[model samples]
Target: ALDQEKKQIEKEMESLNLAKFERLILEKQFRVLSYLIEDKKEKVNIVSCDELNNLLEVLEQKKQRRQDIKSHLDSLNKELACSNFDFEKAMLYRDLIDSEKKRLETVNLSIQQLEEKLAEFERN
Candidate 1:
């Protein structure tokens, strides 16, 4: 029964309407970061202040999206609680979702850190 509940939650999360936009934003930001890194490979000098500013904006937006998804997941958890649902099988699915969230959070943090580093570098 627990397994079934978790699967249900998984299905609901998977079907979340907002996930599509969230994923698109993430992918777009990731592509920009890739291009920035690639551009750095061709230049010997430091990156421009404007470039750093642009990247900071992108990172901030990405972080905001990450936070939004997290909040949505939290809301889903509350829904699960109110439903008084329990299932052992769902535990595995729940763990998977938690792990994926953690991974995305880690990436978000990395992006924030990189942005901070770039800001500091540009300041000097």
Candidate 2:
């Protein structure tokens, strides 16, 4: 019957659409992963759920590192504030604080970029 044929065609079209959508998601994941792994030389063919989980883990580690650097910087600031004498020690603390600040900035930028990429991937 024509009705049966039409129904079969519709089911095939639905299946094809689902497959296309899944492929699109995988492609997006691959692109995001590639961007995140810019420094690595390994070639990535397909992105999997495990890769996304790894990305989340990396993001969390970066956040923890940022917090650690912030706390260390605070301690250095307190030390610098309390030390009225020993100019060399104060200068050393200042240098350490400066380096920590720079590191924090780098981590913050990295986190921002990752979040933006994840958001974009979700949106698409």
Candidate 3:
């Protein structure tokens, strides 16, 4: 009985560790999503005071981000189509995808405005 109890305890510890690891992964993923959505992922460049260069770099990042978002959304949709569909998770991904597209729109607008300003400056 003592040996059985020890084995049970070990199993419980392993399950607890797995749960903790999963929670940490979830937290990290959410943090990444938050940063990507908020345009805060590339802050180290802003410290250099090169607004034009930084803006261009940021626009490139945003373009890459839009591609990533679309891929993720596609994967989520594929998952939703599987035999074991997770409705809640699919809805969550849908919402994130919508927000990501909105952010992309804003980024595009910002890039357009910057290009217009540059053109105007060059004209003068």
Candidate 4:
């Protein structure tokens, strides 16, 4: 029954590996959800199904806001291009564009930081 014991051990190893993989996925999801939900005061270590659904809704809202900002920025760029002959309007558009660019850069940096944190968390 040595062969039987060997097969049992292999099966147990596979099960353990699967459990670890699932845990990693859950942890990553939790981190992302928590990071994106910026207004929440408490950290959620273990999320219920309903909470996950709420987090997903929040994610969609944030995505929509980002899209709106991008669309506004694009329109500003177009306006800037068309208003080159009007010096005052052109300068105003340029300033607006600069502010939007800075905002976008800040958002990008926050995302980068979150990813770095996730990687560090995984390493530990």
lDDT of 2: 0.60
RMSD of 2: 22.6
- TM-scores of the candidates are 0.46, 0.58, 0.48, 0.46
Q: Summarize candidate 4's per-residue lDDT along 46-110 as a digit string, tens digits.
A: 13332444444544544554565577679778766765446765665676677667656655654
The lDDT of model 3 is 0.57
Q: What lDDT tens digits, residue by residue, belong to model 3 across residues 7-105?
A: 675566456646533543454365355545446544555456546666567657756666665665565456446635367655655665566566557
Please give the lDDT score at residue 16 for candidate 3: 67
Top lDDT prediction, candidate number? 2
Model 3 alpha-carbon miss at residue 59, Å: 1.4
Q: How close to the true structure is residue 124 of candidate 4, measured as C-alpha lDDT?
A: 69
Candidate 1 lowest-lDDT run of ten: 38-47
The clash tally of candidate 4 reads 0
- The TM-score measured for candidate 2 stands at 0.58
Best-to-worst lDDT order: 2, 3, 1, 4
Candidates ranked by TM-score: 2, 3, 1, 4
Residues 17-115 of candidate 2 have per-residue lDDT tens digits of 465335434433443343345313112211334255555666776687678768867876886787683776566567667767887897799788767
The superposed Cα distance between candidate 4 and the true structure at residue 25, in angstroms, equals: 44
Query: Worst ten-residue run, lDDT, model 2?
Result: 38-47
Query: What lDDT score is found at residue 34 in candidate 1?
Result: 45
Q: After superposition, how far is residue 117 of candidate 2 from its true place, in Å?
A: 1.2
Q: Could you give candidate 1's per-residue lDDT for residues 1-124 as a string of tens digits? A: 6446646755765676765436534444553454345335323232444366566655665576566556656754665466543585346336535754775676577666767777786888
Q: Which parts of model 1 are misplaced by more than 4 Å?
A: 1-50, 86-89
